[model samples]
Target: MEIKGLRKIEPYVAGSQPTGKNIIKLNTNENAYGPSLAVHQTLASFDAHQLRKYSTLDQAVLRQALSEQLGVPANQVIIGNGSDDILSMAFLAFFNSAEEVLFPDLTYGFYKVWADLYHIPFREVPLSSSFEIDSQDYLVENGGIVLTNPNAPTGIYKPLDQIEEIVKA
Candidate 1:
């Protein structure tokens, strides 16, 4: 069997870099400040012997710290490589061969791509004229609904209570 169609996919083009040494980087939303003092201290004093061990990506200590910070159970918390890892795991859990996923047209551009790659149905629900999703619209039909909290370039955030209600319903 010949593997084909891979070439048809468009390569993801990331944002550009700063031209000069003096240019303050603005494209990627990384922290301008250095790593936390605790993180720095931990890494600086990390034992070399531990490097020989094989631990799963789900490191317990980090997960426990995050769970404590979020006030949620470690089982409920998920750590990922980045936003894409979160998307991938969610799709894996919420979808299968015969399921449809719904997403807002205005949010994360990469969502539809993931659905396509996974062979899951992807529906683009248009936002209201003001470019915001009413919870009612998202609740209608979806195996899972994907949304950005503070939204995108506009940076508008919906209330948490409303988001919780939509997800629960």
Candidate 2:
């Protein structure tokens, strides 16, 4: 049986994993320094007995802490396993085939994949000459916009006022 939205979907090419000891693996999509000391401490203190059951669905404690730190309501937070899971959920929840989603031509790369998977059409607006995301590029009519703040690869960021302009447009 043919899957819907399967046609024209190019397989995602992941970064290369070169195997070797003493080799500096630079292609990783993760932080150069692995988990922090805080993460290690949390893992060490975790209750092994809790492994027998599912984690709490609400993550109340984590959400409360994050809410306090971010000064936002706990209800505004929605934690997930990782960014991929969160992005997948956002794509499925917010976008549809009716109109195209807008994103940068050079970005996290997963945006296109997520759009395709959800059967949502997407348009890629090219960055400026210096590989900077001009907020004006996203002002066109569209269903929704997705972008990486402090854009990847180039690491250029748009100022808050420019971002506000994009949002208002």
Candidate 3:
């Protein structure tokens, strides 16, 4: 059986893994320093017995901790598996199918994937010749906007003033 939206999606391809012994693996953005001592201690102290039963899905403790640390309300702090998970959830929750979402031509590819999977129309605004995102370009009418701060591979970051301009428009 064929699905309607599946046909349009070009599955994302990750960078190839390094094969040779001297290769410096740059794919997946894994941490070079590995887990910290605090992380190791936390893992060592984890209560393995808790794994036997299902825990509540509410992340109030984590949310509260993050809120205190970040100086934001617990309601505003959402803990997720990763940035991708948070972005995916936000996109699905906030974007409307009737309107178009806007994003840069070169950004985290998953933004398009999420839009496609949710049947949310999205428009890709091209980056400038220097691979920088012009906030003015995003001022156009759009249902939602997703932008990478220090845009991927190119690493061009928009200043706060420019970001404010986009939000104000």
Candidate 4:
């Protein structure tokens, strides 16, 4: 039965997970090697009892540490579950305008999904013949821009100066 006023949309289809021995999965950004010794030690020493309680939303301590390491102010640091969570939050916070958001024609598929989910207009600017972002393309009027350095699938990294040019445009 079709429900009234249902928002039907195409969901993001992640890359297939192949199972096998001695296989490294890069599609999902799975670590080629297992976690380092520090991670193992941390997990082993983790207090399972703490799981019963919810974690603090502010994450002040972790944010402060990250800010110190990155040489940024604590207020500028944002810690989330993962890049997906951070990106989702960013989409919600930004990209509210009549102008269309601009991103590469080939990029993480989630960008389109987020835009669709939020009802934000977007345009997928085609990459150069060499599969690199043409900063000139982004110079046009846009609500916002999302450029993934060391882009996914293609693994092409646009130079920092070019990115700055686009930002300053």
Candidate 5:
């Protein structure tokens, strides 16, 4: 039964997980091989007591480290649990205008989910036959544009010059 004043949403469907030995799980971006020895060592030495407390919301240490490595100010860095979290925040923050956002049709599926969830209009520009993003397609009027470098699933990377052209448009 449908409830009054309730928001209905079409959930994002992820790729299937096939179970078997020797199966490499590319659908979920899982590494074929297990974590490196350094990761294992770090986990082995982790303090279980820390789990009882929540981590800092600002993530100052991580942000500072990332900023130092990237040569940017700590205030300019925004960290999230993952790219999905960051992208979701970005969609909500920047795609508030009535104009439609644009992204590649064959890009990450989460873009559509976030757009729908936030009630942001969007359009999917088709990729070229070679699975390359034609920068010209995104040159048209748009509220915003999202491009995944070394695009997901296809693993095709658009050149920096082409990306700059889209940004300039």
Candidate 6:
């Protein structure tokens, strides 16, 4: 049951559980609201039998609907289980075995953990004086890079222009 030289694994820690039924669920950082009425209606209208099939893979029709709602082209959209999934996909698509990934020292620790799990090299770039992401700090090419917006706990959002500059670079 034991694999030799594999004991360096760290445990995953989720936010604390709630103690009361009616207690406010502020722990997970989920928006303090429920799904839209239309979304609820859509769920109620969902056909459970769809699950019996392949479920249309990524469900292009729903993706198109999201594109219309967000005013973005379908080609520009990417589907993922969550941001973590998106991060993993980016690492896979943008990085190679010989390349490295760059991420913040104070952001989601999961990024580094993923890098290690995948055996991808990575560098931890430092945060700014005000805990901001300075894109200019990244100097490597042909490597994956990650940025967690509105970085958790601190919840401070960086400017869109900064992200634009990073993408442009």
Per residue, candidate 5 scores C-alpha lDDT tens digits across 1-169 of: 6799876678988877798888988867779788999999999999989999999999999999999999999999999989899998899889988889999999899999999888899999888999888887988889999899988778998888888999998
Across 1-169, the per-residue lDDT of candidate 3 in tens digits comes to 6787556666767666877765556556766677999999999999989899965577888888999999999999877879879988999899975768999988878888888877889999898998889888898888988887888867888898898898888
Winner on lDDT (5 vs 6)? 5
- In model 3, the runs with Cα more than 4 Å from the true position are 1-8, 19-27
Quote each prediction's TM-score: 0.75, 0.83, 0.86, 0.92, 0.92, 0.73
> How much does each candidate deviate from the true structure in C-alpha RMSD?
3.3, 2.7, 2.5, 1.6, 1.5, 3.3
Ranking by TM-score: 5, 4, 3, 2, 1, 6
Local distance difference test, candidate 2:
0.85
Best by lDDT: 4
Stretches of model 4 off by over 4 angstroms after superposition: 1-3
Q: For model 6, where is the 10-residue window of minimal lDDT?
A: 6-15
Give lDDT for model 6.
0.75
Count: clashes, candidate 1? 0
- Indicate whether candidate 1 or candidate 2 has the larger TM-score: 2
TM-score of 3: 0.86
Candidate 4 to truth, TM: 0.92
Model 1: per-residue Cα lDDT over 25-135, one tens digit each: 654675677589999999999998997987777778888999999999988888788878888888877777454677788777777777877777778888888988788
Candidate 3 overall Cα lDDT vs. reference? 0.83
lDDT of 4 at 100: 98
Model 2, stretches more than 4 Å misplaced? 1-8, 23-42
lDDT of 6 by residue, 1-169 (tens): 6788774545556657877767666646555577899999999999888878665667688789889999999777888888789877877777786766788888777777677777788888888898877777864573767777787545778788877777777
C-alpha-based local distance difference test score of model 4: 0.91
